[model samples]
Target: MFRSNSTTDCVQHITTSVELTPIRNYISELNLVHHSKRVFKLKLNFPKFIVICNNNGARLLELQSKVEENWIDLQCRVRGYGIGVWLGLTDLQREGQYVTMSDACRPRYSNWMRGEPNNGNGNEHCAMYWITRSGWNDTVCKGKINFVSTFKDAMIFCNNLGAELLELQSKAEENWVDLQCRIRGYSYGVWLGLSDVRTEGQFVSLSDARKPRGNFRNWAKGEPSNGGNSEHCVIYWTTRIGWNDARCTDKFNVACKKQKEIAYD
Candidate 1:
């Protein structure tokens, strides 16, 4: 098992992996890597930025407290400064009600600059951290912005590796996921790619928006109650030994699968 505390080993792994690009400033405390700028050339509008990060197994950086804020600031001073980086915060749903994208959690601590979040031009809906000032600012969501990303969340954990959340298309695939988890001694269930977020009770694959083929579903008995309509995402329930609807925001291990290229005869 890779221990996050083993900085030397972590750095070695990151250095050797062509897929990994360590986030420049704050790489020590968090084992995060910035996705390739080549994917979007370092400039993307807020929504696209979120999508890009998600596609690459990452989430936009979130600052939980002043201590974390200071760590980033100090690292920026040590490395160098850029224009700024987008945060995982937005008020798109309701003005003056900024929320984190991962869980819709309201920030318990904030370091907004004085007179900030003024909703400038009545369109600044996304939040960013200015490297030079070390303060937060709300900005226009339409404008392209460079950003720092974190390999947080199950969706991101898989996407970061050029793969996607597992889709159990058959009993064989489902059994494989279960056997792997059991062999590895996973204490909890793994996330599945299916979800009904866009339309209630209509589960679709997150990677490609494909519906399940030919009525193949292994839902656990009494599952998918859509409890409070909050449980939109699906997980392979380890305890129940079948699939169940779950809160999308909650963290879990993920089984990622990438299609293999088949050679033509």
Candidate 2:
């Protein structure tokens, strides 16, 4: 039995004419990786098994056969290690291939042949080994491969997707606020961004010049201090009205502006 002290340490096994059925059985006993509810699938079929780290599905298609020659690893500093491993396995399975999934944190190999330790550390958070009917064959698989270079790269990909979703939600909220302001006929002054200073006994607009651009401006009541000529102004939400100095850098719910209709005789 091949045992590893740490999941990151590499284990090399040489099987002696073992059948595929037993190999599959041994792999089943090991732990399976988990991923997010959403997944991206890939289609790459090979008789040999593959080992990958950190569950990077997006870059799966870019994998090349050359990676098989030397041990490949990826290191991503993301919070979700399980999700990353699950995604990589999911992509492999989608390609009609059952993969041996293991983590750099916990690795367990079944009884098999052995050699000198081929341990390594690199961009690979996960590693994949191509398995064949010959039983854990070691021939370089052929394909184009893409590798992750840094933690920032992985973060940028995830963050950009999140930002896009938020932008869409904000647009919808603005539309709702606009409808509310128009129906009120300017009678209800839409306090788009107002706050009260609880300690200073005053209500102030978030747009106060004295306030920094990073304050939380919920306008809770008696905020803004109003220490220096800081009366809240009725700035059009569509124009500069929505922003106050209090919550300059802080993200807040956006309000819409409605113009008063002029009556012509």
TM per prediction: 0.42, 0.17
Q: What is the Cα-based TM-score of model 2?
A: 0.17
Candidate 2: tens digits of C-alpha lDDT, residues 90-125: 222233232334332222332111421122221222
- Give the number of the best model, judged by lDDT: 1
Score each candidate by Cα lDDT. Answer: 0.61, 0.24
lDDT of 1 by residue, 1-265 (tens): 1223321211112221212223322232121112222222223467775666566456667777776677666654442233456678899899989898888988767888889989999989988877667798998877643211211355665565566667777887677667655543343467777888899999998867878755579999998899887999888877678988888765454455667311000
Best by the TM-score measure: 1
User: Model 1, clash count?
Assistant: 3
Judge candidate 2 at residue 200 and give its lDDT.
39
